[model samples]
Target: MWIWFHKLGSPPHFYRTAGRLVPWFGIPALLLLVAGTVGGLAIAPPDYQQGDGFRIIYVHVPSAYISMFGYVAMAVAAAVGLIWRMKVAFAFAAACAPVGAAFTFLALATGSIWGKPMWGVWWDWDGRMTSVLVLFFLYVGVMALRSAFDDASKGDRAAALLAIVGVVNIPIIKFSVDWWNTLHQPATIAKLSAPSITMDMLVWLLAMVVGYTLFFAAVVTMRLRGEVLLRERGARWIRELNAHA
Candidate 1:
């Protein structure tokens, strides 16, 4: 396990491996996304309460879930980089920031759209909503901090420390609904018992969640490959790679 981990830390190995693995995750993510979208929007029966407006949950819920997942991933990668001084881990953490931010933005936007109809407001200062917004800023802050320094190593360390610190917000975002009275609905899928949703809706929702997770993997791998090339530009293997390309 340690040998394989070290091998993966090598830029050339990771680059070649990521190129080979992209299709495996990317193809399934696309298929599952299509299946989930169709199943949620067209096949699943309407919510007894919100009707078709609730259809947006297919996109909103997955986006929100992924946003939090991305932050956790970023924090873990940052921690790995900081503790082990692994260049690959730093590259991966840097790659996660933008993707996580995009997902967070999507979540907020979709949530607002969903809220406009359900809550009769386009925006609110509710705990969950506010916490998620703060999460978005945290992603931005990490990215900004990383780019702030003239020295790349200093920037990476700064960003990594911030990522580790900012992880506290993730749980707050997750439990905000439960901890406080808020406009946002409590979790339907993430529960100790069976989810409150029906099997039909549940199936598609779960698929979307899986699809989003896979998509994140695909995107991160692609980005990590590029990051490896940039970081390894001075190495001979990169010259060979460029020649091969």
Candidate 2:
């Protein structure tokens, strides 16, 4: 098992395995996204208070969920790269930043759209929104730190350190609504008690979350292969790959 695990971490092996796995993750992600979005938007009953406007959760919730999930995954990968000097982990960490940042942007934009109708304002300085905005910056900062250096090793080290340090914000963002008076609502599905949402809503929302996670995996794996190629351009395996092409 350990031998296989170690082999799996090798760049060539990982690249090949990831290529084979992308379609598995990508296909399911697409189907789930379509199904979840349609169910959430067309089938779920409107909230008595928010009415049809609540349907945006199909996009907003998944984006927001995956935005945070991506950062945590990045931080873990960065930590592994730093501790074990794993090149693949570093590549995975680097790939996660832009994807996470994009999701964070989607979350913020969709949130603002929802807020305009609900809060009578498009933007607010509330704790949840503010912390999430900070989360977005942290993703951007990690990516910027990586590219700012001429030496790839130095950049990876710096980016890894930043990613590890930025983990503090995750908790802050998660609990911001509970810890502070904020217009943003608290957890619906993740609560210690029974979920606030009805089962009908819960089903599709969970599907969206799963779909988002698979989408992240597929996209990050694709990005990871590219990053690995860049880092390993001079390696024999990469040379052979190019030769075969």
Candidate 3:
């Protein structure tokens, strides 16, 4: 295990691994997104309560889930990099910021669109919504910090520290709906009870979640590869890698 960790710290190894994962994740992501979106929008019956307005849940819920998941993943990677001094871990953390930010944006946008139909409002300072908005800002802060330093190593460390600090927000966001009475609905799909939703709705939602997961993996791998190259520009292996590219 230690050997594997050390090996992953190598820029060349990490880059090659990311390259391999791209196609593996990308193809499934594309297929799943297509299936989920089509099934949710056209095949699945509309909600008995919300009617056609519920269709937005297909994108909104998945994006929101992944946005939180992405941040936790990034924070973990940052922690590993900080403690273990693993450059690849830092690269993973760096790759995550932009993708996580995009998902956060998607969640916010889809939530607002969904909200107008259901709640008759476009924005709210509700607990879950507010925390997620803060998450978007956290992503921006990490990205900005990365570019703030003249030295890349300094920037990486600073950003890693910020990521570690920001991790406290994840659990807060997770329980926000439950911790406070908000306009947002409480846990349905992830609750103790065997999901409140029907199998038809469940299947489409699950598919959408899987699709988003794959998309995140694909995008992270692509971004990590670029980070690897940038951080290892002077390395001979990068020259060889670029030659093949």
Candidate 4:
């Protein structure tokens, strides 16, 4: 297991393996996104209370879910890099930042769009909303801290530390509504035995969530390829690969 882990942490190996894996993730992502979109927007019945506006959940919920997933992925990779001195792990963490930030932004935007009609306000400092906003800032902070350093090693260490520390917010974001009296509703599908949502809605929501995850995987894996190249630009393998090109 450790042998495979070591090999995976190698820049050349990750670049080659991840390149081949992109289509696997991307193809499924495209199919699921298409199916989820159609099912949620056209096939599913309108919400009993919110009516058609709830359709935005098809986009908003998935984006919000994926944003948290990306943060956790980045933090774990950063920790691996810090513990084992794995350059590829550090590159993977850096690659996750932008993709996570973009999805966080999308989640916030869609949430606001959904909120205007439902809550009678464009924005509110609800616990979940506030915490998610904080999450977005954390993502930005990690990226900014990384680039702030002129030395690559210094940048990686700084970014890794921040990523690890920021993980505390993940739990805060998850349980924010339960922890506070907020206008934002509690999760609908959290109750496994008796979910508040119907199968028609639940199925598509899960599909969208899975699709978003695969989409993130596809983007981050591609981004990691560039990151690995940048981190290993002077390596013999990179030199030989470029020569062949």
lDDT per residue as tens, model 1, 1-245: 99999999988988899999989999999999999999999999999999998899999999999999999999999999999999999999999999999999999999999889899999999999999999999999999999999888789899999999999999899899899999888888797887898998889998999999999999998998887776777899988887898
CA error at residue 24 for candidate 1, angstroms? 0.7
What TM-score do all the candidates reach, one by one? 0.98, 0.98, 0.97, 0.98
Model 4: how far residue 92 lies from native, Å = 0.7
Put down candidate 3 lDDT per residue, 1-245, tens digits, no spaces: 98897787888888888788899999999999999999999999999999988999999999999999999999999999898888888889999999999999999999999888789999999999999999999999999999999999889999999998999999898899899999989988887778988998889999999999999999999999999888887899978877898
Worst 10 residues of 2 by lDDT: 183-192
TM-score of candidate 4 relative to the true fold: 0.98
Model 2 residue 215 lDDT score:
96
Q: Which runs of model 2 end up more than 4 angstroms from their true locations?
A: none
Return the clash pairs for model 4, or none: none
Error of 1 at 244 (Å): 2.4
Give me the overall lDDT of model 1. Answer: 0.93
Winner of 1 and 3 under lDDT: 1
TM-score of 3: 0.97
Residue 131 alpha-carbon offset, candidate 2, angstroms: 0.5
Model 2, position 148: C-alpha lDDT score: 99
What are the runs in model 1 whose C-alpha is more than 4 Å off? none
